[model samples]
Target: MPESRRRKAAVQKKRAQENVEIEKNRELKGSPRWWAPLMVGLMLLGLIIVVTAYVTGGNYPIGFDNGNYNLFLGFGVMLVGFLMTMGWK
Candidate 1:
């Protein structure tokens, strides 16, 4: 009931709340289950896109096949996406 006691109680409660928040953040960061599957799926999707581009010839001009270039570009984009999904690791 004293003013000093009330202030101390408030401070203690704030500290407890901060501790809980910190723990929650740690649990989230430490979990990799979601990241692993997401990155893999992205990488696979990129591969599919690149393959499709190659098979379609990417509408290259001069009667020459340029699908490989498209494939490489798709792969590059996929790599970046994968890395980003995996936290740039």
Candidate 2:
């Protein structure tokens, strides 16, 4: 092939490869609408539960009869939030 034709072909091939890479990256990117707010809400709710439990001496109805239940529940909620963050962009 002529030198000019070879160069043109190489340029086109490079551009095609770049476009494919860009599309792959776009596909891998996370959803901005769902995970972020959900994660934040989980964390906040966890914190609130923890504080309320602490202030009420674990007597709250949510804890049922055990004072430690709220503590564990709060930590579990917070852990879920942390896990959710991994999916956020």
Candidate 3:
């Protein structure tokens, strides 16, 4: 191969690698639109559970009381997070 051709190929390869890295960084850098809310909701739910448990002295079956509701909420949040993470091109 010619010297110029080899140099061009190397530059192209480097550019491709840089593009891929940028894309990956864009993918991983943020919590995404829905992710932030989902994470915040989950965290708040955890906080509520902890506070309630401490206040009630573990007398109430908090987890059992709203088990399905919380599960559904989590599923919905997870679905949103998944969709957001996918990041449509």
Candidate 4:
């Protein structure tokens, strides 16, 4: 049986709406060129800081030499990088 003209039109309209939504989503699909590099760098920096603190035993003789505070600083940096991932796509 043939679809009624009104029913066909409604389906077409719905498809058009879906297509528009898909295009809108696509527009938001990519991060800026520097975004990914910055994100990864921050995460790596955090890892390095944490490792340095452990190796130095908080006695590096510079700022952030405190044991627990260095850990907190490293984790805070890592957290920011992780949070950035949520907006990446």
Candidate 5:
């Protein structure tokens, strides 16, 4: 018939936690206008690097005499772009 003190406290605590989470989320305001473009650019640049390396035979653009290293370098650039996606909104 009536609410218990313990139950009310628990509900209040839960609500407080939920409110905090909501406020924190609101404060973020999301990513910047240029974020998506930059992220996509990095990813495409990485892909282009690998493709260029292949087309140029790893001797023109990224001169490394060693083809394998060029591949690694290209992949590394791609990885950076992929990693940036994690922070994307």
Candidate 6:
């Protein structure tokens, strides 16, 4: 091939590779619109639950009489929220 043609071909190939990489990155970075908000809400809700339980003397805020279940439940929920955050971009 001529030098000019070779250079043109190389440029085109490079551009095609770049486009493919861009598309792959776009796909990998794609996330639901609600994902981040939901994760933050979950974290906040968990924090609120934990704080409420502590403030209320660990009473059953949801009408149950489990002594310290509320605290554990709050901690569990918070931990789940924290874990979900790891999946966020």
- Against the true structure, whose lDDT is highest? 2
For each candidate in turn, the TM-score is 0.43, 0.68, 0.42, 0.67, 0.71, 0.63
Instruction: Provide the global lDDT of candidate 5 against the true structure.
Output: 0.84
Give the alpha-carbon lDDT of every model: 0.70, 0.87, 0.61, 0.84, 0.84, 0.80
- Alpha-carbon deviation at 82 in model 6, angstroms: 1.0
Please give the TM-score that candidate 6 achieves against the real structure.
Answer: 0.63
Ranking by lDDT: 2, 5, 4, 6, 1, 3
Q: Which stretches of candidate 6 lie over 4 Å from their true place?
A: 1-28
* Candidate 6 residue lDDT tens string, 1-89: 45788888999999999999999988788567888888888888888888888788777465457647887787788888788878777
In model 3, where is the ten-residue run with the lowest total lDDT?
59-68
Candidate 4 residue-wise lDDT, 45-82, digit = tens = 88888888788886442366347888888888999999
- Which digits, one per residue and each the tens of the lDDT, describe model 3 over residues 22-66? 999887775446765665565566556555555665543345554
Candidate 3 local lDDT, residue 13: 99
Model 6 score (lDDT): 0.80
Global Cα lDDT for candidate 3:
0.61
Per-residue CA lDDT of model 5 for 1-89, tens digit only, reads: 99999999999999999999999988788878998888888888888888888888887456887877777877888898888889877
Residues 13-89 of candidate 1 have per-residue lDDT tens digits of 99999999999987667535677667777787777777677666675322336556666667886986667664722
* Number of the candidate with higher TM-score, 2 or 5: 5
Which pairs of residues collide in candidate 6? none
Rate residue 17 of model 3 by lDDT: 100
Best by TM-score: 5
**Against the correct fold, how does model 2 do in TM-score?**
0.68
